[model samples]
Target: MERTLVMGILNITPDSFADGGKFFSFENAIERAKEMISEGVDIIDVGGESTRPGAARVTEQEEIERVVPVVTELVSIGANVSIDTMRSKTAEAAIGAGAKYVNDVSGGLADEKMAKLISRNPNVQYVCMHWRGHSNQMQLKAEYEDVVKDVKKELDERVAQLLKSKVSSDQIILELA
Candidate 1:
């Protein structure tokens, strides 16, 4: 049986579910990533935007500022970094800074350009999470006749879109939220 790899969270926002903005500074963030690495984390998920239940969305540029430099630093130290974002701009910049993966919580709902970005880079890994709207309004939009099936269908369609755009199966990670 294949064992599950532990993913350590490196949240940089002030409203993340648990450890919000507590890890916001670059120096503190780098130290935490290093700690996670030493703790046997297989992937260090660096998030700039807070996706906690009632969190507000940050500007695209702010998200980039919060995550890119950390990704570059992690890359320099050989850390397997995955950026948590749905903004194509942020993902594009993060990938350029050496983020090995993209963790998009909205699964493409937040931005259509995200799928296009994924298609362009078949080598970078992707994690598409189940989501309906922005965190601030997501709670208001969670109603579904059959939540499981609806979420699955949404994910399938997104995956199909990526495949149609030429993103190979090997480069994507469909996150089941």
Candidate 2:
């Protein structure tokens, strides 16, 4: 078994639930990433949009502003950065800025271009999370006949789509949250 990996959450925006911008500055973000490295974080999940309950939607430009710089700096320092976003534009920009992974909580629902980003980057890893809609209204529609089974089913379909898009199956990881 690969064992449980500890992934550090880095919210670069100003509205994240717990530690939003508390570490958003480029210097502080880099320092915090280093701290996570010291504490043994396998992946540094970098999020520009806040998906917290009741969080507002962040635009693509704003998201890019929050994520890219941090990603480039983190990569320069040798940290494994995972860009947490749903928009394909944001994903492409982030990966270009040195992120090696895409952590989309929407699971390809919110943005249609997500699959394309994965398709174009064969070496990039993908983390797909279960999502119904934007956080502004996602919770009201949380109804699953078979929670676990449905989660697996949805994840399987996402994996299939990625495969069809030319994304290697080994590069995809399903997140059941």
RMSD of each: 1.4, 1.5
- Candidate 2 lDDT tens digits, 1-177: 689977899888777787856976777877888999999998899998899887898889998998899999888888889999989999999899888899999888888778888888988998888777788887887899999898888888877877887778788888889
Off by over 4 Å in 2: 1-3
By summed lDDT, the worst window of 10 consecutive residues in model 2 runs over 18-27
Task: Encode model 1's per-residue lDDT on 40-150: one tens digit a residue.
Answer: 998899999988887777899999999999999999999988999989999999989988889999887788888789878877988978778887888899898998899
Clashing pairs in 1: 13-21, 14-21
TM-score of model 1 (CA atoms): 0.94
C-alpha lDDT of residue 72 in model 2: 90
Give the candidate number with the greatest lDDT: 1
List where candidate 1 sits over 4 angstroms from the true fold: none
Ten contiguous residues minimizing lDDT sum, candidate 1: 13-22
lDDT values, one for every candidate: 0.87, 0.86
